[model samples]
Target chain A: MSAPSLFLTVESEGGAVCLRLAGVLDYDTSDELAARADACIEQGPRAGELHLDCEKLRLCDSTGLSALLMIHRRTTARGITLFLDNPPPFMERMLSVTGTRHLFAPESGKARQSCPDEVRETTD
Target chain B: MAPPPGIPVTRTGERQASGVWSTAPHPVLESAAGGVLTEVNPAASRLLRGARPGVRLADAAPAWLARADQDLRDRIVNGSGDTDGGASGWIGARSFEAHPSRSGNGNVVWWLVEDTDRRRAEEALATERERTAFLTEASHVLLSSLNTDRCVSATARLASEYLAEAAVVVSPARGGKLPLAHAVGGQDVVRSLVAADPSQLPGLDEALQGFPPVASRWIDPAALPAWMIPEGYTGTITSVVITPLPGQGVPAGALVLLRSGGQFTENEQIFARLFAARAGAALSAAHLYAEQSAITHTLMQDLLPPRLHRVNGVEFAGGYRPAAAQERVGGDFFDVHHAGSDGDDSSLVVLGDVCGKGLEAAVLTGKIRNTLQALVPMADDHQRMLGLLNGALLNSHHTRFATMVLASVRRTDHVVRLRLTSAGHPVPLVVRADGRVDEVGTHGTLIGALPDIESRTAETVLRPGETCLLYTDGFTEARGGPLGDEMFGEERLKRALSECADMPAEAVVERIQMLAAQWVRGGGHDDMAVVAITAPRTNHLSAVDGHTRGRYTA
Candidate 1:
């Protein structure tokens, strides 16, 4: 069977960067996501926030989670707040299961309202 | 006088007699039947060097032309001169075709047409074809093997056979010594490592460093060092061409071509460079492959799972398969470490899966195994051990995490007591002698992801003929089936383990692996690992006779 592919699109608005991740994010595609995140970070200092839109993300394997953690480490080093805009249920469970939800906490109230189920699931 | 029927008479009427015979562009001569020169045209005198009316044909013309005139006269005297006389010979450096016509008085008029240009062109075409064929064959031979030594030898042999009298392929210096493969003519290649300096020759060092070659004329053959020429070569080296064998970024080597005769033409030198390019690429590939394989082999030797055996009276068996079939080791790993000398009777068995796959994951797996090995002294407290491991991971630079299950097994009386704990990993499954399967109640966050980790340890006892199985998520997450996308879920694994209730530890592990492999036939998979801890059934009949089958006396 053909493997699933990952696509990334980056946009800068109001001094903030938003990287949209779609399709599978497993071993084969994790490096690409990490590279894109590095490229976004290399675009000089932004409005202290980097948002990752995961609304269309289909799957995130352990390696994919590791890439997100790496990105988190990079942004934290630069004092940039990172947020997961709209994580799916599986990603939320993965974060909760690994106990890394606090590391990538979404700061915006709109993001929190969009992922209310994710917050409730993590709390449970 | 009418010209011979086969000959073209270009000049007409008044000038036809003398003009056609004298003013012709081709060299013409008239010789008598007695081998004497009767008349010589101006063209003939200019082309033949020494031609006069009284001189003998043999003294004025080349031997082949003179012999052809004598043979024609003999044929005419024998009344059989029906065939036209034609002969080809070289006068000085120029070649010519001699055509003869006989007159009524038996004097033969000879016409010589120069064909030097046509002959040289044919010779050039033949040489070009030969070089093309040699290059095609050289490519095939050079690429036949990915062995560095074999590639070096092939390059030397091909250059000697076609381009020069002898050749030497000198590899990049290693450990202050250069490896050389030398060949002469069609003889076997000889390889040796010599400590000779490359700077002895003007361009040798630069060529070895991947610089463009110096012109062949600039390198004097008298400057060749003793090591540069192959042994037993008797001829004096008249010319040498040193060309760099360029590789991927770095230089692979240098090719030294030696000739005892004339210097190489510009075309020949260009062809030699082309040949070196092909040889360099093949040699570089071979070197790269050797280096990579050596590295992978060394790393795999350390990371591959150990062979499980009976440890501390508890039967232990493990099976592991990497994600890719061609790969040897991946993220999933298992280890059985005998209990430390801390008065603990239990042996620690750890099964874990690091994030990601292939060599990167295997490296992390190695680190985790080493850390756990060092922490075996604290096997009694599972939660404390996990917390320490979590801190170690968090302090390190790697952001990747791992899921793992640790089981401390102790055999007592007729049962095996076990303390099992899971850190964001699949819980251990217990299979009873009555074909009942139960999942241990233990869960926690994965290691390396968070600072503070929480884990609950569950204690259990396995009676005789019961087994406890700890596996990685790769077992339940294997995606395959008739549809090729269905997961081999936990339910399926539990059912498969239920059928192995009274089996030996090795048999149980093998059965689970077989079922999973069948479910994911030829499909992509994550790395899967399983370790089984079984309580051995007492063999009551083993003391009476060694041949009889033992009946469980639990």
Candidate 2:
């Protein structure tokens, strides 16, 4: 009966679009991330970079991970750089568990990258 | 045009030349006082040329000519009377307007005027009416079925029958390939069309741009792609109109209409679009239905129990039914695990219900099932397995939790040993051969609710012809009774089990499900799950270690 435990917010900063993902990122809420990612890519992302801030993300399930992979596929296909900024420990664990840890660029020190690199790593 | 072979027209033997005869626009046929045809204008000659021209007016003109003749006679009788009475009718395929006038010599001048535009307008109105009726029938047929293939086939058939002689419906398949979902036409025509790539079909790509229907001529068959003209296809197509089919969020497909003769008219194009719209809606519904079924299948994969296989002389059976209101898999889950791969003597079984419903609870159920499977190495140590599972749940960091009954059964030739562990789940029931049911297993706190969880294990031995059952709270919490508010509580379930004591393991599960369904009276209920293990009535083989059943009992 309660509202979904997950929420997402999108903003533009320094010529880059930042997607702040909060709360649980499980099966019920994964589609939101996918839709937002698709919109950002289609509308040119305000810049050449998309930053996913996952500091408040509490959980991620298998379906949620699949959605993330879809977002990654869309971003790279459009030549837009994607950054995983400040992912919580649980998100990191999920990424490794699903063997999709290589899709997102590693966080650089404490500063989030608005536009990182042209060369990104991906796996089949 | 020449006149017909009969009814010769001989100009009246009176004055044949008049100044007005040279320039009159409409045909003028004059008759003498005795009703004999007189002077015939050049226009009149051209108008009546297709029929018997030299005949009497009554024979040459339509039925309205008699009325005109009567008016002419009256005019001749009354000098001051005006007899230019106009009569309109059809001669052959052309419509005509005839006027009768009295001349100074008492002769009648019949002026005939053709109306081609009116005839064209009437024909167009009839075509539109037929098209509207055809479109209505097409919509009804398209909407009758939710099967995607059937809808596509019907759309193609209707398009060919009403819109064109040949038709094809194209939709995007996996990998961005556009496949022809349906094609309707003669064998030769369909073969040529089937050879063509849907994406490369003329006008189809343009229509897929979300524009209106696009009409184009198949300019050159020889210049088309090799696949477009199959070797055995001998027919030729001249015109094609592709109309895009709109879907829920995107274009569902494209409808291609082909003609062997003239180009499609403007009205035909419009009708094709309207027909495509209906076909689009039906296709969209079909796609959504397929998607929903796929999601349900995936959800049921986890919501339903694992394959119930007989293990180590012990038979296991389980059944699950989701709530009627939910078109999804609920939070209930069950699994039966054999301890070791070889001739393992012990097996572990778990049936649990997560705290919430829908996908969230389903995720938690998956986590529980996986954790239990991983802990099978420690199945011999029932308390250790429970403690490890509890720790794993606490570390999951999610709010969801579950209540489960984990039972490990070890079977000998004559008796079966069970180590039952309860995590806030229902107490395991032992059904004896004499139809006596007793509850076993200690009550424990719910799993994943808190850290440092308190769990317990109860040990019991099942003699031959005895059975044990484990279930989730869905069984007892199901509502509907004589009062309509009463829950089918544990007592009722216990009584139901007592009646099934003489049945096999599968029948026991079936009887309980029947009782629960009847208690709910076909009303709403939570997801229910039951797993029962029965020991055979007689042991046909000796026990392991070359020992008989008496050693274990003693």
Best by DockQ: 1
Clashing pairs in 1: none
Model 2 per-residue lDDT tens digits across residues B68-116 = 6766686667865666567777776888776665566667766666675
DockQ, cand. 1? 0.39
Top of the candidates by lDDT: 1
**In candidate 1, what are the lDDT values of residues A2-38, reduced to their tens digit?**
7548877776666667777889898788888898888
Can you write out model 1's per-residue Cα lDDT over B1-554, one digit (the tens) per residue?
Answer: 12234555332222245456686777878788678887677888998877977799999888999899888888888988464868887999998888777665667778788888987898899988997888788888888888999999999999998889999999999899989988999578999899989999899999999999998999999999888788788889999999999999999999999999899877888989999999999999999988988888999999999999876667899999888865788999999987747555679999998997777787888889999998998888988889888887784466789999999988776679998998988789999999999999887878986666788889899998899999987888899988999989889999999999889999999999999999999898888999999997765544533224456476
Residue runs of model 1 more than 4 Å from their true location after superposition = A1-4, A9-20, A35-56, A71-124, B1-45, B48-140, B165-184, B190-281, B395-398, B540-554
lDDT of 2 by residue, A16-118 (tens): 7777777877657777778877887787865687888787887665456656656766777688888888988757754552234666877767335553333
DockQ of each: 0.39, 0.02
TM-score against truth, every candidate? 0.74, 0.60
Give all candidates' CA lDDT scores. Answer: 0.84, 0.70
